[model samples]
Target: MDLPRHHTIRESSHRILDPFTDAQLATLGRALHLTPGTTLLDLACGKGELLCTWARDHGTVGTGVDLSTVFVAAARERAASLGVEVTFVQGDASGYVAESAVDIASCVGATWIGGGVVGTLDLLGRSLRPGGIALVGEPFWRTDPPEAALAIGDFVTLPALVEQTRDAGWDLVEMVLADEASWDRYVAAQWLNVRRFLDENPDDELAPALRHELSTAPLEYVTHQRPYLGWGVFALVRRP
Candidate 1:
């Protein structure tokens, strides 16, 4: 989807859209060696949850850039509310450059930077200093990706994702699989926001379509796919 619609949908349901869990966040924090002074660049940072949380807990300095102006605004608001000084910019994360090299560069759940994992790492590397960590949050099919799986949205298998990263000069530092409970939380939380949106704007043009999509999504997700799909965080570091 384009920026306008994508931002609208995400903004409408950012609260419901649980992007990560406690374990996943802890894993990333540990992998990045998050500290008061550690700096990270979050590419394609959707609403800047990862960066904002890290900044608040770890006292780290970070920035998140996304193409969605609405998300950028929300992220900025989140940072301010948390009293963290994270800079959220509305820009193209695919090519956004930092003023200085960073210690950790991540593109969680957004591999559009390099068109895939390999390319995303290459992009992260360009912005990292020596010995920096590159974290990628991705979804991996729990089993082999069937031909019919192509009907599903943007995702690749675990093996293929690992292969691509290794081939791109990275070593897996850590990995944490998101349990089914986490997935349930992530999906279920969004329904609240969708419901709220529908309640507030009953006459909205897209409300019907959004409601239909959400109503059927869980069934399609659990029955048709959840049994065979996995979500995880992969933290990799550039080799010296």
Candidate 2:
């Protein structure tokens, strides 16, 4: 029903919970060419940055669904602080569908909620209007990794991801990719967050676990995840 406290602590300061930076997110929003009053349904919308920012910048309204209660509360607070009226529901996003077809439907970074890419697209399709845009944020393998490294991540190559979209009867429209610097920033930030949390709460039960993660995560990132992992947000339209 809620995310583990340690997970929230590790991402304590993150607004966009993925590899995307604020500038990259803004670029993606702009690329969508969202008009005023466009309706969006954002699944796994961590911290509601996309909804709140789009509302403030593009005048689009949206609802965000996430399983993390901490993120849901933060998302609500973000919308309020931004003076944008958007709803953030703390629940399983995969099970929720809009009452009416939404102009845009997105499942970003949490595709496992629908099993995988194809299933996630099917879930998103349930909420999208005909010809509506589907924004899917996913990770792919930038380079082939060793079997042990591959065990840590499950992702296809970028070309294979594109093929998955086409195979699912969607036309690829546009995509925004995360560069190496952005990936480094994101992973490094998480390490810092975990370190800060441990520093402030050394006696806490989760501190040891966090400390262990911090000890190994940086080297792991530099060795396998960083060099081999690729992330992107793809825009697609369901084909007739």
Candidate 3:
């Protein structure tokens, strides 16, 4: 629907499509000690960067599901280009069920697919083999939230976020946090994407809205998101 369409447009120029730099993502894969033949399922796997890169770097096999048709196509193309054996599917990732239990079940940066972080962990758990890992990317508060930050919804400070993860029945094994620069890198690129689109399709119905976002988003991010919000991909394992 509109969400997928908007995402495709907003992130057209992205490869990883999250706040993570390529180095950080590679750090995660290495920290996990990824082995050849590891099987992974990624839900809401935008552009399938995580899966595709892991497949190439660690010899992992993966399936990635996303709602954006163009993203899915791009993912497939990326896999082919990398000579990695990974599958990409276009569909509603919220209800995706992997064909089989996988060594890793991940829903990074798109936990809304299962409502929120805990629910997403549960969803990923459903497709994880025993002893498998569940990877979730989520936002946490870095400092005391201002009144404006409260509107960001349900995000707690880092310690509480970790506690919440533990309460959700997983042990947080490893994490990779995004800094202010990373946030800027992820969002500033969207401004360029929107500008390019609007320049080419000035008459498009979405143009005005995008123009509004382009005008307002940078300030909003600098004022609120950059200082207060921290995002990270967390590696989880079932609690004993």
Candidate 4:
């Protein structure tokens, strides 16, 4: 299926869908020293949170593209509410290029749009101006995962992740990682969202799936992802 409706429903209540807190997002902006008039292009941008917030705080302007119509609508509403110079389009992010090259290009938390991390980097590069930054949010193996966890994901170790970026023709310049707290917040919020959704739409078609996921997700995270998986957004510069 080219489109998955379930993820949008599962994360309906989230603004920043990744494991990054608002503080961490602000920290990344500060670390980048974002100035007025900088432009961003975010592929697979969830709710356009990065674009809207950066536009508000750093005086940047940006465009975000995501596949989910609901997310794009939400992003537009957010932009209107925040009075930000940003546009969110609903379409497949893979192979989408900006009309004009942007200062920053990113595919955070959805590298699958381009198949994987390296592939996503190549896709993000297509919309980047010369010497502009590329950002990728990805998961790494914090430690060796058990066979079960390995079966669940295809993550590499952190060092290997850096090497993959290098191989993909970018230098990993900076990164902001998620600790257990941020991870918990991101994952735990889904439970509440699912609970609320189920309560409101008990007879909906997705209820069974959501109920099944809610029942098992916490245990799954604690047993597998918690100890082994780590997520972060890494900033990159094109290799000279």
Q: In lDDT terms, which candidate is top?
A: 2
Which model, 2 or 3, shows the larger TM-score?
Answer: 2
lDDT of 1 by residue, 189-234 (tens): 6666677777878888888787897788778777756676787778
Reference-based lDDT, each prediction: 0.77, 0.92, 0.90, 0.90
Candidates 1 and 4, the one with greater TM-score: 4
TM-score of candidate 3 against the unseen true structure: 0.96
The lDDT-based order of candidates, best leading, equals 2, 4, 3, 1
| TM-scores for candidates 1 onward, in order | 0.89, 0.98, 0.96, 0.96
Where's the lowest-lDDT run of ten residues in candidate 3? 1-10
- Which residue ranges in model 2 land beyond 4 Å of their true spot? none
lDDT of 4 by residue, 1-240 (tens): 235777887788889989999999899989899999999999999898999999999999988998888888899999999998798888989879999999999998999988999888888888899999999999999988999898668889999999988887898889999888999889898899889999999999999989999999899999998888999999999897
lDDT score for residue 219 of model 2: 94
lDDT for model 2 comes to 0.92
Clashing pairs in 1: 16-190
Q: How much lDDT does candidate 4 score?
A: 0.90
Q: RMSD to native for every prediction?
A: 2.4, 0.9, 1.2, 1.3
* Alpha-carbon deviation at 169 in model 3, angstroms: 1.6
